[model samples]
Target: MARVLTAKGAATRRRILEGAAELLRRNGTAGVSLELICQTTGSSKSQLFHYFPDGRAELFCAIARFEADRVISDQQPHIEDLSTAESWRAWRAAVIARYVEIGRYCPVNALVVELSRTGPEAEGIVLDMQSRWHTLMTQAVGRLQAAGGGCRHVEPEAAASVVLAAVQGGASIYQATGDFVHLERALDGVLSYVGVA
Candidate 1:
């Protein structure tokens, strides 16, 4: 059976997890041993094991989930209420601004790329994040169409895929080359077609 934690234990685990995330952000995946995490977080092996009994795999999965959630949350109210054309534009800007600010230091993308090579748990985290993001964009397209903002001729689902692809492709290029032009143009082109940009 799994161990149930009291509030203090939960807090301790949370601290360790967050500290590890910061360390990963600063150092990437290199030299990130459990011992390093313990030293950085002031956590003992017993405490780390008590929280993450499955060891490094368990902790990495947890970190992936956290990073995946950040991808969605970073888009914020814009993504949530993409009902209006303005909201869609805001969402587009948010997406670009986020990547621009983060530049090549996107740990979520890094974590996804790195951990995905390991196993299903990590792959599933990326899949879930993509699925939810696509669903939201698709739903927003439909709502915008109903509001007479989105192009009536374009299928909401297809349009969502286009924009999602644009964002994803553009982001990958930007993250690789540290250039903003691709992301900006891709988002603008797709968003303009969708009557948002």
Candidate 2:
């Protein structure tokens, strides 16, 4: 059973998790260590173990979840309100700007890579995040069509899937070759298909 943490204990756990996430983002999974996390967060190994008894596996999974949340929350307001061409364009820009600013050090991707060989949990986390993200976009597409904003002939579910795939492909390209053009072009193509270009 999971331990029930007091408010103070929960806050401490959160502090450690956030600090570790920041370290992971700054250095990638390859460069971060638990000791570094302790030093950076001013937490002891005992505290970390108290919060995450499974040690690195548990802690890494927690970070993956945290980063996954960031992936969606970062695109807020625009992602939530895509009822017009203006909103769609803004959402596109928000997506591009976010990835561009990160410049390939995506903690979510890093954790996925780091934990892929370990087990299925990391993949599950990514899949869950993607599902939630795609659902939100799918709903946004439905909203646009219902509002008579655009995408009249487009299929909401498929369009949203394509948009999500475009982003993944684009981000992969950017991470692989540090090229931004392909991601932008891919997104433009999908947006055009959805009649928002």
Q: In order, how many clashes per candidate? A: 0, 0
Candidate 2 runs further than 4 Å off: 1-11, 22-32, 39-42
How does residue 65 of candidate 1 score in lDDT? 80
Model 1 Cα displacement at 111 (Å)?
4.7
Identify the leading candidate in terms of TM-score.
1
lDDT of each: 0.79, 0.82
Q: What is the TM-score of each candidate against the true structure?
A: 0.84, 0.82
Put down candidate 2 lDDT per residue, 36-103, tens digits, no spaces.
98999999999999998888778878887888888889789798999888898998899889987878
Clashing residue pairs for model 1: none
Candidate 2 lDDT score relative to the true structure: 0.82
Model 1 vs truth, CA RMSD: 2.5
